[model samples]
Target: MRVLGVDPGLTRCGVGVVEGVAGRPLTMVGVGVVRTPADAELGHRLVEIERGIERWLDEYRPERLAVERVFSQHNVRTVMGTAQASAVAMLCAARRGIPVALHTPSEVKAAVTGSGRADKAQVGAMVTRLLRLDAPPKPADAADALALAICHIWRAPAQNRLQQAVAAHRTLKGRTA
Candidate 1:
Protein backbone atom coordinates (compact mmCIF):
# COMPACT_ATOMS: atom_id res chain seq x y z
CA MET A 1 0.00 0.00 0.00
CA ARG A 2 1.08 3.56 -0.69
CA VAL A 3 0.43 6.12 2.04
CA LEU A 4 0.95 9.85 2.23
CA GLY A 5 1.50 10.92 5.85
CA VAL A 6 0.82 14.50 6.81
CA ASP A 7 2.12 16.30 9.92
CA PRO A 8 0.06 19.42 9.82
CA GLY A 9 1.21 22.78 11.15
CA LEU A 10 0.57 26.39 10.36
CA THR A 11 4.03 27.32 9.12
CA ARG A 12 5.60 24.00 8.24
CA CYS A 13 3.36 21.09 7.43
CA GLY A 14 5.35 17.92 6.93
CA VAL A 15 4.58 15.46 4.14
CA GLY A 16 6.02 12.03 3.41
CA VAL A 17 5.11 9.13 1.15
CA VAL A 18 5.84 5.48 1.88
CA GLU A 19 5.01 2.34 -0.07
CA GLY A 20 4.97 -1.23 1.13
CA VAL A 21 2.90 -3.84 2.98
CA ALA A 22 3.14 -5.21 6.47
CA GLY A 23 5.99 -7.60 7.44
CA ARG A 24 8.18 -6.54 4.51
CA PRO A 25 10.64 -3.87 3.55
CA LEU A 26 9.15 -0.44 2.92
CA THR A 27 10.31 2.30 0.58
CA MET A 28 10.28 6.01 1.13
CA VAL A 29 8.80 7.41 -2.05
CA GLY A 30 9.25 11.06 -1.05
CA VAL A 31 9.50 13.42 1.95
CA GLY A 32 9.23 17.17 2.31
CA VAL A 33 7.61 20.03 4.19
CA VAL A 34 4.98 22.47 3.01
CA ARG A 35 5.90 25.89 4.28
CA THR A 36 3.66 28.91 4.55
CA PRO A 37 4.86 32.25 5.77
CA ALA A 38 4.02 32.72 9.46
CA ASP A 39 3.05 36.27 8.70
CA ALA A 40 0.59 35.32 6.02
CA GLU A 41 -3.07 35.85 6.71
CA LEU A 42 -4.95 32.91 8.19
CA GLY A 43 -7.00 32.36 5.06
CA HIS A 44 -3.97 32.73 2.84
CA ARG A 45 -2.00 30.23 4.88
CA LEU A 46 -4.82 27.73 4.63
CA VAL A 47 -4.92 28.24 0.87
CA GLU A 48 -1.20 27.70 0.64
CA ILE A 49 -1.54 24.52 2.66
CA GLU A 50 -4.33 23.33 0.39
CA ARG A 51 -2.23 23.97 -2.72
CA GLY A 52 0.75 22.17 -1.29
CA ILE A 53 -1.28 19.16 -0.17
CA GLU A 54 -3.07 19.05 -3.52
CA ARG A 55 0.24 18.97 -5.37
CA TRP A 56 1.39 16.07 -3.25
CA LEU A 57 -1.83 14.16 -3.83
CA ASP A 58 -1.55 14.72 -7.57
CA GLU A 59 2.03 13.57 -7.68
CA TYR A 60 1.95 10.65 -5.25
CA ARG A 61 -1.57 9.38 -5.89
CA PRO A 62 -1.32 7.46 -2.66
CA GLU A 63 -3.93 4.84 -1.85
CA ARG A 64 -4.35 6.21 1.67
CA LEU A 65 -3.63 9.42 3.53
CA ALA A 66 -2.45 9.21 7.15
CA VAL A 67 -2.80 12.45 9.07
CA GLU A 68 -1.82 13.36 12.60
CA ARG A 69 -5.01 13.89 14.59
CA VAL A 70 -5.26 17.27 16.27
CA PHE A 71 -5.36 17.07 20.03
CA SER A 72 -6.14 19.65 22.66
CA GLN A 73 -3.10 21.66 23.74
CA HIS A 74 -2.53 24.36 26.25
CA ASN A 75 -1.72 26.78 23.49
CA VAL A 76 -5.08 27.33 21.92
CA ARG A 77 -3.61 29.43 19.11
CA THR A 78 -1.18 26.74 18.11
CA VAL A 79 -3.80 24.05 18.33
CA MET A 80 -6.15 26.09 16.18
CA GLY A 81 -3.58 26.41 13.45
CA THR A 82 -2.82 22.73 13.55
CA ALA A 83 -6.49 21.85 13.35
CA GLN A 84 -6.90 24.16 10.37
CA ALA A 85 -3.93 22.70 8.58
CA SER A 86 -5.16 19.20 9.32
CA ALA A 87 -8.56 20.03 7.87
CA VAL A 88 -6.89 21.21 4.69
CA ALA A 89 -5.07 17.91 4.31
CA MET A 90 -8.23 15.88 4.87
CA LEU A 91 -10.05 18.07 2.37
CA CYS A 92 -7.44 17.47 -0.30
CA ALA A 93 -7.55 13.71 0.18
CA ALA A 94 -11.35 13.66 0.23
CA ARG A 95 -11.44 15.59 -3.02
CA ARG A 96 -9.45 12.81 -4.67
CA GLY A 97 -11.52 10.07 -3.03
CA ILE A 98 -8.49 8.84 -1.14
CA PRO A 99 -9.12 7.14 2.19
CA VAL A 100 -7.94 9.17 5.16
CA ALA A 101 -6.74 7.84 8.51
CA LEU A 102 -6.18 9.95 11.59
CA HIS A 103 -3.61 8.77 14.11
CA THR A 104 -2.83 10.40 17.43
CA PRO A 105 0.69 11.52 18.32
CA SER A 106 1.03 8.93 21.04
CA GLU A 107 -0.34 6.23 18.79
CA VAL A 108 2.19 7.06 16.12
CA LYS A 109 5.01 7.16 18.63
CA ALA A 110 4.06 3.82 20.10
CA ALA A 111 3.81 2.19 16.70
CA VAL A 112 7.23 3.41 15.61
CA THR A 113 9.19 3.38 18.84
CA GLY A 114 7.41 0.89 21.11
CA SER A 115 6.54 3.63 23.56
CA GLY A 116 3.71 6.09 23.43
CA ARG A 117 5.75 8.58 25.47
CA ALA A 118 8.78 8.41 23.22
CA ASP A 119 10.50 11.68 22.59
CA LYS A 120 11.15 13.30 19.24
CA ALA A 121 14.67 11.96 19.14
CA GLN A 122 13.53 8.42 19.82
CA VAL A 123 10.81 8.59 17.16
CA GLY A 124 13.22 10.04 14.64
CA ALA A 125 15.80 7.38 15.37
CA MET A 126 13.24 4.65 14.92
CA VAL A 127 11.91 6.18 11.71
CA THR A 128 15.45 6.40 10.36
CA ARG A 129 16.07 2.76 11.08
CA LEU A 130 12.68 1.58 9.82
CA LEU A 131 13.11 3.26 6.44
CA ARG A 132 16.80 2.28 6.27
CA LEU A 133 17.91 5.84 5.88
CA ASP A 134 21.43 6.85 6.83
CA ALA A 135 20.16 9.97 8.55
CA PRO A 136 16.94 11.02 10.19
CA PRO A 137 14.66 13.28 8.20
CA LYS A 138 15.22 16.92 9.15
CA PRO A 139 13.17 19.41 11.20
CA ALA A 140 11.61 16.71 13.36
CA ASP A 141 8.33 17.36 11.60
CA ALA A 142 9.59 15.66 8.45
CA ALA A 143 10.66 12.63 10.44
CA ASP A 144 7.30 12.66 12.17
CA ALA A 145 5.49 12.55 8.85
CA LEU A 146 7.50 9.51 7.82
CA ALA A 147 6.80 7.86 11.16
CA LEU A 148 3.06 8.36 10.64
CA ALA A 149 3.28 6.57 7.31
CA ILE A 150 5.25 3.71 8.81
CA CYS A 151 2.76 3.35 11.65
CA HIS A 152 -0.16 3.17 9.24
CA ILE A 153 1.56 0.65 7.02
CA TRP A 154 2.23 -1.67 9.92
CA ARG A 155 -1.19 -1.34 11.50
CA ALA A 156 -3.45 -1.39 8.44
CA PRO A 157 -3.62 -5.15 8.09
CA ALA A 158 -4.92 -5.74 11.59
CA GLN A 159 -7.32 -2.82 11.30
CA ASN A 160 -8.76 -4.24 8.09
CA ARG A 161 -9.30 -7.61 9.72
CA LEU A 162 -11.09 -6.05 12.67
CA GLN A 163 -13.37 -4.10 10.37
CA GLN A 164 -14.20 -7.19 8.37
CA ALA A 165 -14.99 -9.13 11.52
CA VAL A 166 -17.32 -6.42 12.74
CA ALA A 167 -19.12 -6.32 9.43
CA ALA A 168 -19.59 -10.07 9.44
CA HIS A 169 -20.92 -10.02 12.99
CA ARG A 170 -23.41 -7.30 12.09
CA THR A 171 -24.61 -9.30 9.11
CA LEU A 172 -25.02 -12.45 11.19
CA LYS A 173 -26.93 -10.57 13.88
CA GLY A 174 -29.23 -9.06 11.29
CA ARG A 175 -30.01 -12.51 9.87
CA THR A 176 -30.83 -13.88 13.34
CA ALA A 177 -33.11 -10.93 14.09
Candidate 2:
Protein backbone atom coordinates (compact mmCIF):
# COMPACT_ATOMS: atom_id res chain seq x y z
CA MET A 1 0.00 0.00 0.00
CA ARG A 2 1.16 3.50 -0.69
CA VAL A 3 1.36 5.63 2.45
CA LEU A 4 1.87 9.34 2.91
CA GLY A 5 3.28 10.35 6.25
CA VAL A 6 3.08 13.86 7.64
CA ASP A 7 4.91 15.72 10.37
CA PRO A 8 2.89 18.82 11.00
CA GLY A 9 4.56 22.00 12.11
CA LEU A 10 3.39 25.50 11.35
CA THR A 11 6.72 26.84 10.24
CA ARG A 12 7.84 23.68 8.46
CA CYS A 13 5.65 20.69 7.71
CA GLY A 14 7.43 17.53 6.61
CA VAL A 15 5.96 15.01 4.20
CA GLY A 16 7.11 11.63 2.91
CA VAL A 17 5.61 9.04 0.61
CA VAL A 18 6.46 5.33 0.60
CA GLU A 19 4.78 2.60 -1.40
CA GLY A 20 4.77 -1.12 -0.63
CA VAL A 21 2.97 -3.82 1.31
CA ALA A 22 3.93 -5.13 4.75
CA GLY A 23 7.54 -6.11 5.51
CA ARG A 24 8.94 -4.54 2.41
CA PRO A 25 11.38 -1.76 1.61
CA LEU A 26 8.96 0.54 -0.08
CA THR A 27 9.86 2.78 -2.95
CA MET A 28 10.38 6.41 -2.07
CA VAL A 29 7.71 8.19 -3.99
CA GLY A 30 8.60 11.61 -2.61
CA VAL A 31 10.02 13.52 0.35
CA GLY A 32 9.97 17.23 1.09
CA VAL A 33 8.79 20.02 3.32
CA VAL A 34 6.14 22.69 3.11
CA ARG A 35 7.38 25.87 4.65
CA THR A 36 5.33 28.82 5.82
CA PRO A 37 6.48 32.06 7.34
CA ALA A 38 6.50 31.99 11.09
CA ASP A 39 5.34 35.57 10.96
CA ALA A 40 2.32 34.67 8.90
CA GLU A 41 -1.09 34.76 10.50
CA LEU A 42 -2.72 31.57 11.68
CA GLY A 43 -5.20 31.69 8.81
CA HIS A 44 -2.35 31.96 6.35
CA ARG A 45 -0.56 29.03 7.91
CA LEU A 46 -3.69 26.92 7.68
CA VAL A 47 -4.10 27.81 4.04
CA GLU A 48 -0.53 26.81 3.33
CA ILE A 49 -1.04 23.51 5.08
CA GLU A 50 -4.27 22.84 3.20
CA ARG A 51 -2.65 23.57 -0.12
CA GLY A 52 0.44 21.51 0.66
CA ILE A 53 -1.59 18.49 1.71
CA GLU A 54 -3.81 18.82 -1.34
CA ARG A 55 -0.80 18.81 -3.59
CA TRP A 56 0.59 15.75 -1.84
CA LEU A 57 -2.72 13.96 -2.26
CA ASP A 58 -2.70 14.70 -5.94
CA GLU A 59 0.90 13.74 -6.45
CA TYR A 60 1.17 10.64 -4.29
CA ARG A 61 -2.40 9.34 -4.47
CA PRO A 62 -1.69 7.31 -1.41
CA GLU A 63 -4.02 4.61 -0.10
CA ARG A 64 -3.48 5.61 3.52
CA LEU A 65 -2.22 8.69 5.33
CA ALA A 66 -0.33 8.72 8.60
CA VAL A 67 0.33 11.74 10.78
CA GLU A 68 2.19 12.47 13.96
CA ARG A 69 -0.18 13.19 16.79
CA VAL A 70 0.11 16.52 18.56
CA PHE A 71 2.36 16.44 21.59
CA SER A 72 1.74 19.15 24.15
CA GLN A 73 4.92 20.49 25.64
CA HIS A 74 6.13 23.79 27.06
CA ASN A 75 5.49 25.65 23.87
CA VAL A 76 1.76 26.12 23.98
CA ARG A 77 1.69 28.30 20.89
CA THR A 78 3.76 25.91 18.80
CA VAL A 79 1.59 23.03 19.92
CA MET A 80 -1.53 24.87 18.80
CA GLY A 81 -0.15 25.59 15.36
CA THR A 82 1.06 22.04 14.95
CA ALA A 83 -2.39 20.84 15.90
CA GLN A 84 -3.94 23.09 13.29
CA ALA A 85 -1.64 21.70 10.62
CA SER A 86 -2.41 18.19 11.73
CA ALA A 87 -6.14 18.89 11.47
CA VAL A 88 -5.70 20.24 7.97
CA ALA A 89 -3.75 17.19 6.84
CA MET A 90 -6.31 14.80 8.32
CA LEU A 91 -9.15 16.74 6.72
CA CYS A 92 -7.47 16.52 3.35
CA ALA A 93 -7.17 12.76 3.65
CA ALA A 94 -10.76 12.39 4.86
CA ARG A 95 -12.14 14.47 1.99
CA ARG A 96 -10.55 12.02 -0.42
CA GLY A 97 -12.13 9.03 1.40
CA ILE A 98 -8.71 7.76 2.42
CA PRO A 99 -7.93 6.18 5.73
CA VAL A 100 -5.90 8.26 8.22
CA ALA A 101 -3.87 7.01 11.15
CA LEU A 102 -2.26 9.03 13.93
CA HIS A 103 1.00 7.89 15.46
CA THR A 104 2.69 9.59 18.36
CA PRO A 105 6.24 10.83 17.83
CA SER A 106 7.42 8.40 20.45
CA GLU A 107 5.56 5.54 18.85
CA VAL A 108 7.07 6.42 15.51
CA LYS A 109 10.54 6.51 16.97
CA ALA A 110 10.04 3.24 18.79
CA ALA A 111 8.65 1.52 15.73
CA VAL A 112 11.51 2.68 13.57
CA THR A 113 14.46 2.69 15.96
CA GLY A 114 13.62 0.28 18.76
CA SER A 115 13.49 3.07 21.33
CA GLY A 116 10.62 5.36 22.07
CA ARG A 117 12.81 7.99 23.76
CA ALA A 118 15.29 8.12 20.92
CA ASP A 119 16.57 11.51 19.82
CA LYS A 120 16.05 13.09 16.43
CA ALA A 121 19.54 12.25 15.24
CA GLN A 122 19.10 8.68 16.37
CA VAL A 123 15.81 8.40 14.54
CA GLY A 124 17.39 9.94 11.46
CA ALA A 125 20.28 7.52 11.58
CA MET A 126 17.96 4.55 11.92
CA VAL A 127 15.86 5.78 9.03
CA THR A 128 18.96 6.11 6.90
CA ARG A 129 20.06 2.59 7.76
CA LEU A 130 16.61 1.07 7.30
CA LEU A 131 16.04 2.71 3.95
CA ARG A 132 19.63 1.96 2.90
CA LEU A 133 20.48 5.52 2.03
CA ASP A 134 23.94 7.00 1.68
CA ALA A 135 22.85 9.90 3.86
CA PRO A 136 20.06 10.50 6.27
CA PRO A 137 17.10 12.35 4.83
CA LYS A 138 17.83 15.99 5.35
CA PRO A 139 15.88 18.14 7.79
CA ALA A 140 14.87 16.28 10.90
CA ASP A 141 11.20 16.84 10.14
CA ALA A 142 11.40 14.95 6.86
CA ALA A 143 13.15 12.05 8.53
CA ASP A 144 10.46 12.06 11.19
CA ALA A 145 7.85 11.95 8.47
CA LEU A 146 9.54 8.97 6.86
CA ALA A 147 9.66 7.28 10.24
CA LEU A 148 5.94 7.85 10.63
CA ALA A 149 5.27 6.12 7.31
CA ILE A 150 7.48 3.22 8.30
CA CYS A 151 5.63 2.90 11.59
CA HIS A 152 2.30 2.79 9.84
CA ILE A 153 3.58 0.13 7.47
CA TRP A 154 4.64 -2.04 10.39
CA ARG A 155 1.33 -1.50 12.13
CA ALA A 156 -0.94 -2.00 9.13
CA PRO A 157 -1.35 -5.74 9.37
CA ALA A 158 -3.05 -5.90 12.78
CA GLN A 159 -5.34 -3.14 11.67
CA ASN A 160 -6.14 -4.91 8.43
CA ARG A 161 -6.79 -8.17 10.24
CA LEU A 162 -9.12 -6.47 12.66
CA GLN A 163 -10.93 -4.77 9.80
CA GLN A 164 -11.31 -8.05 7.95
CA ALA A 165 -12.69 -9.78 10.99
CA VAL A 166 -15.18 -7.00 11.52
CA ALA A 167 -16.32 -7.19 7.94
CA ALA A 168 -16.74 -10.93 8.13
CA HIS A 169 -18.83 -10.60 11.27
CA ARG A 170 -21.00 -8.00 9.59
CA THR A 171 -21.55 -10.23 6.58
CA LEU A 172 -22.46 -13.18 8.74
CA LYS A 173 -24.94 -11.08 10.69
CA GLY A 174 -26.54 -9.81 7.49
CA ARG A 175 -27.06 -13.33 6.16
CA THR A 176 -28.57 -14.62 9.40
CA ALA A 177 -32.29 -14.77 9.93
Candidate 3:
Protein backbone atom coordinates (compact mmCIF):
# COMPACT_ATOMS: atom_id res chain seq x y z
CA MET A 1 0.00 0.00 0.00
CA ARG A 2 1.11 3.52 -0.68
CA VAL A 3 0.65 5.85 2.28
CA LEU A 4 1.13 9.59 2.43
CA GLY A 5 2.12 10.87 5.83
CA VAL A 6 1.60 14.47 6.86
CA ASP A 7 3.37 16.26 9.68
CA PRO A 8 1.28 19.39 9.87
CA GLY A 9 2.56 22.80 10.91
CA LEU A 10 1.53 26.23 9.74
CA THR A 11 5.02 27.25 8.71
CA ARG A 12 6.51 23.98 7.59
CA CYS A 13 4.24 21.01 7.01
CA GLY A 14 6.08 17.83 6.10
CA VAL A 15 4.69 15.52 3.44
CA GLY A 16 6.01 12.07 2.56
CA VAL A 17 4.91 9.14 0.46
CA VAL A 18 5.91 5.58 1.23
CA GLU A 19 5.04 2.29 -0.38
CA GLY A 20 5.03 -1.18 1.17
CA VAL A 21 3.09 -3.53 3.36
CA ALA A 22 3.75 -5.17 6.70
CA GLY A 23 6.81 -7.42 6.70
CA ARG A 24 8.00 -6.11 3.36
CA PRO A 25 10.63 -3.65 2.27
CA LEU A 26 9.36 -0.10 2.03
CA THR A 27 10.26 2.51 -0.55
CA MET A 28 10.13 6.25 -0.35
CA VAL A 29 8.13 7.60 -3.24
CA GLY A 30 8.48 11.25 -2.32
CA VAL A 31 9.28 13.59 0.58
CA GLY A 32 9.14 17.34 1.04
CA VAL A 33 8.11 20.18 3.29
CA VAL A 34 5.36 22.71 2.54
CA ARG A 35 6.28 26.17 3.70
CA THR A 36 4.00 29.14 4.28
CA PRO A 37 5.10 32.50 5.54
CA ALA A 38 4.30 33.02 9.21
CA ASP A 39 3.16 36.49 8.39
CA ALA A 40 0.50 35.25 5.99
CA GLU A 41 -3.10 35.55 7.05
CA LEU A 42 -4.52 32.42 8.65
CA GLY A 43 -7.06 31.98 5.86
CA HIS A 44 -4.44 32.40 3.16
CA ARG A 45 -2.08 30.03 4.97
CA LEU A 46 -4.76 27.39 5.17
CA VAL A 47 -5.47 27.78 1.46
CA GLU A 48 -1.81 27.39 0.68
CA ILE A 49 -1.68 24.27 2.80
CA GLU A 50 -4.77 22.89 1.09
CA ARG A 51 -3.20 23.45 -2.31
CA GLY A 52 0.05 21.83 -1.28
CA ILE A 53 -1.70 18.76 0.09
CA GLU A 54 -3.84 18.50 -3.03
CA ARG A 55 -0.78 18.59 -5.23
CA TRP A 56 0.85 15.79 -3.27
CA LEU A 57 -2.31 13.72 -3.40
CA ASP A 58 -2.54 14.18 -7.13
CA GLU A 59 1.07 13.32 -7.70
CA TYR A 60 1.61 10.41 -5.33
CA ARG A 61 -1.97 9.16 -5.36
CA PRO A 62 -1.57 7.42 -2.03
CA GLU A 63 -4.20 4.90 -0.97
CA ARG A 64 -4.14 6.17 2.58
CA LEU A 65 -3.13 9.32 4.43
CA ALA A 66 -1.59 9.16 7.89
CA VAL A 67 -1.43 12.43 9.76
CA GLU A 68 0.13 13.25 13.09
CA ARG A 69 -2.55 13.75 15.66
CA VAL A 70 -2.51 17.17 17.25
CA PHE A 71 -2.05 17.04 21.00
CA SER A 72 -2.20 19.61 23.75
CA GLN A 73 0.76 21.96 23.95
CA HIS A 74 1.58 24.92 26.18
CA ASN A 75 1.21 27.29 23.27
CA VAL A 76 -2.41 27.53 22.20
CA ARG A 77 -1.53 29.41 18.98
CA THR A 78 0.85 26.73 17.91
CA VAL A 79 -1.63 23.99 18.64
CA MET A 80 -4.36 25.79 16.77
CA GLY A 81 -2.21 26.23 13.69
CA THR A 82 -1.25 22.58 13.80
CA ALA A 83 -4.86 21.46 14.14
CA GLN A 84 -5.85 23.67 11.24
CA ALA A 85 -3.10 22.31 9.06
CA SER A 86 -4.08 18.78 10.00
CA ALA A 87 -7.66 19.49 9.07
CA VAL A 88 -6.61 20.60 5.61
CA ALA A 89 -4.71 17.36 5.09
CA MET A 90 -7.71 15.30 6.17
CA LEU A 91 -10.02 17.28 3.93
CA CYS A 92 -7.77 16.79 0.93
CA ALA A 93 -7.65 13.04 1.46
CA ALA A 94 -11.35 12.75 2.16
CA ARG A 95 -12.18 14.61 -1.05
CA ARG A 96 -10.16 12.04 -2.94
CA GLY A 97 -11.76 9.10 -1.10
CA ILE A 98 -8.55 8.03 0.55
CA PRO A 99 -8.60 6.50 4.00
CA VAL A 100 -7.16 8.77 6.70
CA ALA A 101 -5.51 7.73 9.96
CA LEU A 102 -4.27 9.88 12.80
CA HIS A 103 -1.38 8.54 14.82
CA THR A 104 -0.10 10.14 17.98
CA PRO A 105 3.49 11.39 18.18
CA SER A 106 4.40 8.68 20.66
CA GLU A 107 2.80 5.98 18.53
CA VAL A 108 4.88 7.03 15.55
CA LYS A 109 8.06 7.18 17.65
CA ALA A 110 7.42 3.74 19.08
CA ALA A 111 6.68 2.28 15.68
CA VAL A 112 9.83 3.62 14.10
CA THR A 113 12.32 3.48 16.98
CA GLY A 114 10.89 0.92 19.44
CA SER A 115 10.58 3.60 22.11
CA GLY A 116 7.91 6.15 22.73
CA ARG A 117 10.40 8.54 24.27
CA ALA A 118 12.72 8.49 21.27
CA ASP A 119 14.15 11.88 20.41
CA LYS A 120 13.99 13.58 17.03
CA ALA A 121 17.53 12.50 16.24
CA GLN A 122 16.71 8.88 17.01
CA VAL A 123 13.57 8.98 14.93
CA GLY A 124 15.39 10.58 12.02
CA ALA A 125 18.19 8.06 12.20
CA MET A 126 15.77 5.15 12.37
CA VAL A 127 13.77 6.48 9.45
CA THR A 128 16.90 6.81 7.38
CA ARG A 129 17.86 3.27 8.30
CA LEU A 130 14.42 1.86 7.63
CA LEU A 131 14.06 3.51 4.25
CA ARG A 132 17.64 2.56 3.49
CA LEU A 133 18.48 6.12 2.69
CA ASP A 134 22.10 7.15 2.96
CA ALA A 135 21.23 10.30 4.88
CA PRO A 136 18.40 11.38 7.09
CA PRO A 137 15.69 13.70 5.78
CA LYS A 138 16.28 17.27 6.81
CA PRO A 139 14.47 19.74 9.07
CA ALA A 140 13.04 17.04 11.38
CA ASP A 141 9.55 17.53 9.96
CA ALA A 142 10.42 15.60 6.81
CA ALA A 143 11.62 12.57 8.78
CA ASP A 144 8.66 12.76 11.10
CA ALA A 145 6.37 12.61 8.07
CA LEU A 146 8.09 9.49 6.82
CA ALA A 147 7.85 7.95 10.27
CA LEU A 148 4.11 8.56 10.30
CA ALA A 149 3.79 6.75 6.97
CA ILE A 150 5.86 3.85 8.23
CA CYS A 151 3.77 3.63 11.36
CA HIS A 152 0.54 3.38 9.39
CA ILE A 153 1.95 0.86 6.93
CA TRP A 154 3.00 -1.43 9.77
CA ARG A 155 -0.12 -1.01 11.90
CA ALA A 156 -2.94 -0.79 9.34
CA PRO A 157 -3.34 -4.51 8.83
CA ALA A 158 -3.97 -5.25 12.50
CA GLN A 159 -6.14 -2.17 12.80
CA ASN A 160 -8.29 -3.32 9.88
CA ARG A 161 -8.78 -6.74 11.45
CA LEU A 162 -9.84 -5.20 14.74
CA GLN A 163 -12.34 -2.94 13.00
CA GLN A 164 -13.83 -5.86 11.12
CA ALA A 165 -14.18 -7.89 14.29
CA VAL A 166 -15.93 -5.05 16.08
CA ALA A 167 -18.32 -4.54 13.19
CA ALA A 168 -19.17 -8.23 13.07
CA HIS A 169 -19.79 -8.32 16.80
CA ARG A 170 -22.10 -5.34 16.57
CA THR A 171 -24.04 -6.92 13.73
CA LEU A 172 -24.48 -10.15 15.69
CA LYS A 173 -25.63 -8.31 18.79
CA GLY A 174 -28.07 -6.19 16.87
CA ARG A 175 -29.67 -9.24 15.23
CA THR A 176 -30.01 -10.96 18.59
CA ALA A 177 -31.58 -7.84 20.10
Best by lDDT: 3
For residues 1-177, write the lDDT of model 3, one tens digit per residue: 999999999999999999999999899999999999999999999999999999999899999999999998899999999999999999999988999999999999999999999999999999999999999999899999999999999999989999999999999999999
Candidate 2: regions farther than 4 A off: 163-177
TM-score of model 2 relative to the true fold? 0.90
- Candidate 1: residue 36 lDDT (0-100): 99
* Model 3, CA-based lDDT: 0.96
Off by over 4 Å in 3: none
Per-candidate alpha-carbon RMSD to the true structure: 1.3, 2.3, 0.7
TM-score list, all predictions: 0.95, 0.90, 0.98
What would the per-residue lDDT of candidate 1 be over residues 1-177, giving only the tens digit for each residue?
Answer: 999999999999999999999999999999999999998899999999999999999899999999999998899999999999999999999988999998999999999999999999999999999999999999899999999999999999888999899999999999999
lDDT-based ranking, best first?
3, 1, 2
Clashes of 1: 0
Best candidate (score: TM-score): 3
Worst 10 residues of 3 by lDDT: 72-81
Q: Model 2 over residues 29-98: C-alpha lDDT tens digits?
A: 7889989998888898899889998999998899999999998999999899889899999999999999
